[model samples]
Target: MVLFDRILLAVYSLFFTVVFILFSAVMLGWPVPLFLLKDIFYPGRPEIFWPLMVILILVGGRLFWSSLHKPRGRHVVLTESALGEIKVSLHAIEDLVEKVAAQINGVREVTSQLFAVPQGVGIRIKASVTPDVNVPAVSVEVQNLVKERVFEVTGLSVSNIRVTIESISAKKPRVE
Candidate 1:
């Protein structure tokens, strides 16, 4: 998350924490410092209080909804010729990456994720390879293969490709 988002979340969390403590104190009949917010709830000032409530509700509601509804990743605009436009989803790119990675010789299992970058898209791949495979060489191969195939198919430049070798699996040899 960005710095602004972190700060906003911290403020929201602090506000809720204080509110919870105050309410719990009141319910438990414990000594409470209600004076801290006494001016905020001035009974004589409906004009000020109502507007504050409205503003708080609107802003809080918006923030609540935003937290629940995360933003979707951006799509790649492949073509914008005189005739029309073509957009490709990040999921499709991820699928392509997985397929390409699977085609590599020593890869045992593979999954891919994509992120939008300024020039085009960035790819992150996680895979399990055969136990005997060379780690550095295979990693480079995976990266190159994914980048080449994605660009060949989608015509979108891959900003970068990262390959993480999650595990090395050994398959038992069959005895005849």
Candidate 2:
């Protein structure tokens, strides 16, 4: 998330955490917290009462909504056979791509991401390779090999494969 969202979540979490801890202390009959706190809601003016009620209502509503929310999983369905459709998780595809890409000669490190597209799946690969390797040839090889392998293994057509040579490894290939 962006900076503001992270900050807001942190602030909201901290506020609730502190309030709960103090509440537990009060329930346990801790003298320090009980003495220091003032009763802000005890038969007071409507200004404080209504605004605090609104804030609490909003907080409760947010909590209830969050409790019912479910995170969306990244998956795609392909109708391959007469039985039914096969569902493939994008994360599993990413792992397969990473393993295949890292097995390439002269590649020091490999990472991949898979996205489901209308045409098919789109793969983005980031790799660190040895400095002596030809970047253009390796990039093309990576793309072709990844595309073929994914389709061969998963029966899913790959719309495209993007390779980003993120860095060149300083270590040179050793002579046998």
Candidate 3:
């Protein structure tokens, strides 16, 4: 699936680039190669305008079709049964983990990054906890929250959850 996706993206990119170069040539009134303009239809002599419009329309149509057929998001899995390996976007998984961690009690802030490994997601979570919060307990809570949220949202199991307590806020200094 990953290979197929890359191939499709490459094809799409190539098509767009060719279209862009051709359009630029047309706009600048530069003569286009006869072979490149063979398939294009023009009422009279092949004017740059008509061919340009045709290329634009074709590119637009391809984009629309690809968008319709494309996966909803990077992290989405297309099939349940895996004949081969599946790749999920680390960014999407990280965003979900951060969201989950933010919901935990005493969590002031949460930031996370994900690393891709075979078979599962590896996550690193950095959290700011309340001054009075227990660091170890908070770490555990964050780990569990991240795991559940990522699994629920992305359908990907987390293999590792490394939690770091960055800083704890101290109580406001008493007024003199």
Give the worst 10-residue stretch by lDDT in candidate 2.
Answer: 35-44
Poorest lDDT segment (10 consecutive residues) of candidate 1? 31-40
lDDT of 3: 0.73
Deviating ranges (above 4 Å) for candidate 3: 1-88, 170-176
Candidate whose TM-score is highest: 1
Q: Count residue pairs with overlapping backbones in model 2.
A: 0
Candidate 1 structure quality by residue, lDDT tens digits, 1-53: 44655676778778779877876776777655465445566767788778878
The true-versus-predicted C-alpha distance at residue 98 of model 2, in Å, is 0.3
Tens digits of per-residue lDDT, candidate 3, 120-155, equal 668888878887778999899888877887777667
Ranking of all candidate structures by their TM-score, best first: 1, 2, 3
**Candidate 2 lDDT, 104-163, residue by residue in tens:** 898867889886678867888999999888999999999989989998988888998889
Return the TM-score for each candidate structure: 0.66, 0.63, 0.48
Error of 1 at 130 (Å): 5.8
**What lDDT would candidate 1 get against the real structure?**
0.80
List where candidate 2 sits over 4 angstroms from the true fold.
Answer: 1-72, 80-82, 171-176
Question: Judged by TM-score relative to the true structure, which candidate is superior, 2 or 3?
Answer: 2
